[model samples]
Target: MVLQILFIAIALAGVALFSYNLKKVIRNIRIGKAANRTDQPQKRMMTMVKVALGQTKMFFRPIPAFLHLIVYAGFVIINIEVLEIMIDGIFGTHRVFGGMGALYNFLIASFEILALGVWLGCAIFLIRRNIIKLKRFSGVEMKGWPKSDANYILITEILLMTAFLVMNAADAKLQAMGAAHYTTVGSFPVSQFLMNLLPNTEGALIAIERGCWWFHIVGIFGFLNYLPYSKHFHIMFAFPNTYFSNLEPKGEFSNMQSVTNEVKAMLDPSFTPPEAEAGKFGAKDVNDLTWVNLMNAYTCTECGRCTSVCPANITGKLLSPRKIMMDTRDRLEEVGKNIDKTGNGFDDGKSLIDSYISREEIWACTSCNACTQACPINIDPLAIITELRRYAVMEESQAPASINAMLGNIENNGAPWKYSPADRLNWAKES
Candidate 1:
């Protein structure tokens, strides 16, 4: 009874703490302006199914994708055993599902196999990131905590899997010794080989089994809480983010509604423009961006796929799409913290522009959508970049000399060149 009470308390506390943190994340996401992603609900559902559930885009790189698929499958399948653990924990029963007989055996055996796959997959990933030092894993944005976070996650998985296997091995040994409360259940194809290493004494076996049981559950709880602060939070946010993906043509830029309204008012004598919204041109901070844009920032996995395929980054420019997402998330978190410290109206005098992201980085993008195409989860860093550029041009009236000259030509000549429409054909007029 005491053990069951302790287990229940720990589980409840872990869940409560996680809920509080997640509420803060949702509130932060809601700080941004509204967007119309509810249109085409069927298409959005299918998008989530294809990308987040099917993981079709991960196959662009076969090796890592296969490894990731193994880990993903393993993590999901093995967690089914956690259900049994919870039931047993709550009732102080030993292997409550063991009464299912052959079915239980099959489930346990399959879990062991998958646990092994997760173990090996995580090991290889760690080697690739640390020993091999893959180019995608090394960058200005990946330096401090991002690099360490990946390593920590892999190491933690390996430890959890080890604990799980060791616990099974100890339990099997205890059952063979006819120990009290040690039921003869489960077929351990993988942990069976590990039995010889354990002791013959029943007390020692029980201690080992129970210790590992506690460790595995506690580690899972810790990992659950750690996810929100880590890049791995994509495991949860990826579905909604992919569902709300922009389904428009990649090359098409969304015209600012404010600008369109102003233009219409100028052209028509009696046209009444709608009242300005937030009275801001483009996004100067997180509050100015759409909610989906903010969600995209939070969903970024920092896998560097977007940055790796980015033309600007490839051509030695400072515009890393991964960095742009990271900057937005970091700045948004900063704003959230400021609001928590002071009231809702608090301002730290910092904005997303100039403070986190630079004008040069924003201007370096070719708007080719290569980054968006390469992302496995469809995170659109290009959207954030475009907003930053818009704020610079319309609000600050600040742009590079070349861009200013181009805008001048567009306004006067109706094109992005010095020549007029009449002279557009002069070059091809056999001159």
Candidate 2:
């Protein structure tokens, strides 16, 4: 009765959490608009298959990637065992892959080996994140996050996997002590070896087996409940996030619409345009951004891949690509409530250029597209930076003086270098 209730509760919780997240994802997809690009259907489908199904991005870093693959594959394959356990717990009988019983045993053995691989992989990841402290692996430096979150998650995953192995081991021992189960004979070796060491007592071995089963089930369910709130939330979100990632021209900026001009034109066409408003354009709040931009903020795994590849960051500029995502997410969270209450989400008077992202940071971008290229989830930081640049130069006239001089030269001299137009043909003739 206890087992039945526990199984039902866990099953319900899993379904509820998955359903809520799935609904949010669907809502985002319906609302999120990507600019129509050529051959989009093929591109989108291929990207979905390659990145989402193939686990391509995780492979960019070999050790972590390999470990992740093991864990991912194990999680998928071992789910059969989980279902069997649930059914047995409820019905008091094993109802699983009955035909090709030998193959089923082989599958179980494979997952057992894979479980150990996952534990080892997670251990290596923990060491790299905490002790080794590589700059590339340093995710967003949240101010108040407990230092123990990563450690705790890693330890829990390892313990859970170990419990699974121990459960099998305990079962193998029971089988050797005169149990006639086919799964016990061929599905586990470590447990079988350990069982030989135990006394031939059915009651004692059965008790041990039951304890391990409970431990394994409890650990797995506990981890599942904790997943959404943790950094490991990416484990579930990443696949969908990758599938729905924005694929657009990385070099271009989104067109910004000006409200001041529209308002003034509506009020009085004869009134002269405001000088201060001439060049003011950029996103001042979440609603001002495109839905895709908003989705980008939520999809960020805080993996620091963008930060690592940022030329601005490498050259000692104040901008961290990771921080751009973090800041956007933070501000969205802050202003979202206000937007919800009042339905006023636009920039009343604040300029995003001066207020949120500084001029120095905006100008520091080289437009090298390295950040975009390095991103695993197709986040185009270069494009975001360029959009801000467009707002600064065209809308606000707040660009560096050098840019104005260059533009002037382009206008009057027909060259950005301030060279005479007559000299353009001279170089060609000489060459």
Candidate 3:
């Protein structure tokens, strides 16, 4: 009865989670729209697949990357055991892989070792985030965030994974003590050692074994249900986000509608045209943003690599690349929910430059492309900043005086520095 109940519970939970994730996938696809790309479709797909499955981005930090590689590899390989357990729950039989007992034992030992490595990695990450207190790790000026939420999610994942390992060890010990000696004696040395310490009574061993199994199963299910609402949501979001990353000419900017055509009729001969409504110039809400930009927000892992590389953040500028992504995501979720409830979308009249992000924060960016180059998931922060700049200067006429002066000089003298046009040939002369 206990086994039967466990089977039913696992099946129901798995179905529910699969259904929920499917709906989210469909919704994101509909929202993503159609993007024109300059890169060959096949090349872009290959790059995305390599990065997503290969853990390419985590390698920015070698120690963390190595540890994560072990854990990731183990997670992928050890899922066979999970499938076997699910099968056993459905059928009365326990072991599903009858032919490869030796291989199964070897895999179990490998996963156990990897689980230990993962624990160490989690410890290092926790220490870095909490004790080291590096500026880059802070992400942004926003006080509560990533520091708190990120820590919570990381700790929970570590705990859950640790529980899985403990439960396995206990189950192995129980099996070795019982009359059913299914496993090869020499292959499972750790279980053999553990069996020496445990009681021989069937009822007592069975109770303990059942308790551990329940913990393992419940831990997995709880982790799944909590995922979407937690910082760890990125685990699920990252896959699809990577799959749909922008695959275009990195040097080129997205084209905007011709401003002349849209506003020519609105112009009055006697009066200057009032600034076009705000949301028209830059993204003020989720719907206003390109689908790729939205996916960038979802994909960010808050790993602080971008924040570490950001020149502005390095120089004590208020910008944190990670925070920029987080803030955009937060604002999008907030505005999306409001729009959903009220059926009234963005304010539509306010420029993103003046309302959403400050001019100082925007202009402080040096276009060094460090953030873009550093992002693990191919998020192009520099591109977004440049697009916003284009809107501000060309559409809104809200650029700083220095920028206007530079433009004027370029127009009058054919150079931004007001150098003589004749001097252009001087560089070619021997100097």
Candidate 4:
């Protein structure tokens, strides 16, 4: 009973910390400009189910996909056992759910298999990131904390699974000896192999079991706290992010309402344009982008899949869609932190355009949408790129001479060519 009470206190404290961090994250996300994603509820919900839950986009690379699926399944499914652990901890009970007989055995067996799968998946991911040294894993953006973050998750997951297996192994050994309170409860087909390494004594087995139990649960709580500081927060944010993803056609761009209104009045000579509020053109800073854009920032897995498929990156251009997303998130976080520190209303002088993302990098994009398609979580870095381009062209009129010429031609000749519409047929002859 004393141990049970102590466990409850620690668990509640962990829960409190997690909730506080989660609230701060939500506050940061809300700092972004408003965007309405409330339409098409059924469609959005279906997308969340299929894309986030089903992981439909992950299968684009079969090997990583399969391995990721195993880890994802283990992470999700093993939490069911955590619920039982919580029950046992609170009630001072041993094998509380063991009363279910065959069902309990099946559950235990399945958990053992999943725990094994989790370890296997983590091992391979570690090898790929460190040993084989996959190119995507080693880039300018993945230096320092990013690389360490990946390694930390992989190592911690492996250790947690090992702890679980060790506990099961000791428990199985205890059961074999008919030890009191240890109970012949769990079926440990996988951990049974570890039995020979463990002592047959009752006291030693109990100590082993308790130590592993404490480590596993405490580690889980620590991981929960670690997530808000890491890209691994996507494990929780992906669902809502996918649900709120922009459903516009991939090829379509969202024209600003201000631009649309101006064009309408220009087309109709006598039409009266509404009194506009004089909004700033395009995305000069994090505040200029929509809340969904900010949500995309939070949802980024930093997986480098977007960068891997980028034609610009492949062709040796300065642009990397993955980097674009990271920079946006980083800048947004900086702005948010500034706001928190100064207790002011969004007065950060550093904009995302020149401070974080460069003009050359934004302009290098072909707008191919490959990055958007390749993203497993539906992150559209292309959208952020386009908005930044809009800022350069409209807000600052900073487009290149060649682009300026094209824009002038369109305004004057209704096409990219310098010639008038009447001379359009002369192109073939001139060539």
- Report, for every candidate in turn, its global Cα lDDT versus the true structure: 0.91, 0.65, 0.64, 0.89
lDDT of 1 by residue, 6-50 (tens): 999999999998999899889999998888889999999999999
Best candidate per lDDT, number? 1
1 or 4, greater by lDDT: 1
Q: Candidate 3: where is the Cα deviation over 4 Å?
A: 1-11, 14-18, 21-34, 141-145, 179-204, 237-240, 246-249, 257-281, 345-356, 411-413, 418-431
Taking the tens digit of each residue's C-alpha lDDT, what string does model 2 give over 268-332?
Answer: 98866555434335544444445556556666666777788787888777887766665655555
* Angstrom error at residue 305, model 4: 1.1
Task: Estimate TM-scores for all models.
Answer: 0.98, 0.76, 0.81, 0.96
Q: Candidate 4: misplaced stretches above 4 Å?
A: 426-431
Between candidates 3 and 4, the TM-score winner = 4
Q: Judged by TM-score, which candidate is best?
A: 1
Candidate 3: 10-residue stretch with minimal lDDT: 181-190
Clash pairs (backbone) in predicted model 1: none
What is the Cα-based lDDT of residue 359 in candidate 3? 67
Q: How many backbone clashes does candidate 3 have?
A: 3
Stretches off by above 4 angstroms in model 1 are none
For candidate 1, the lDDT comes to 0.91
Q: Which ranking of candidates, highest lDDT first?
A: 1, 4, 2, 3
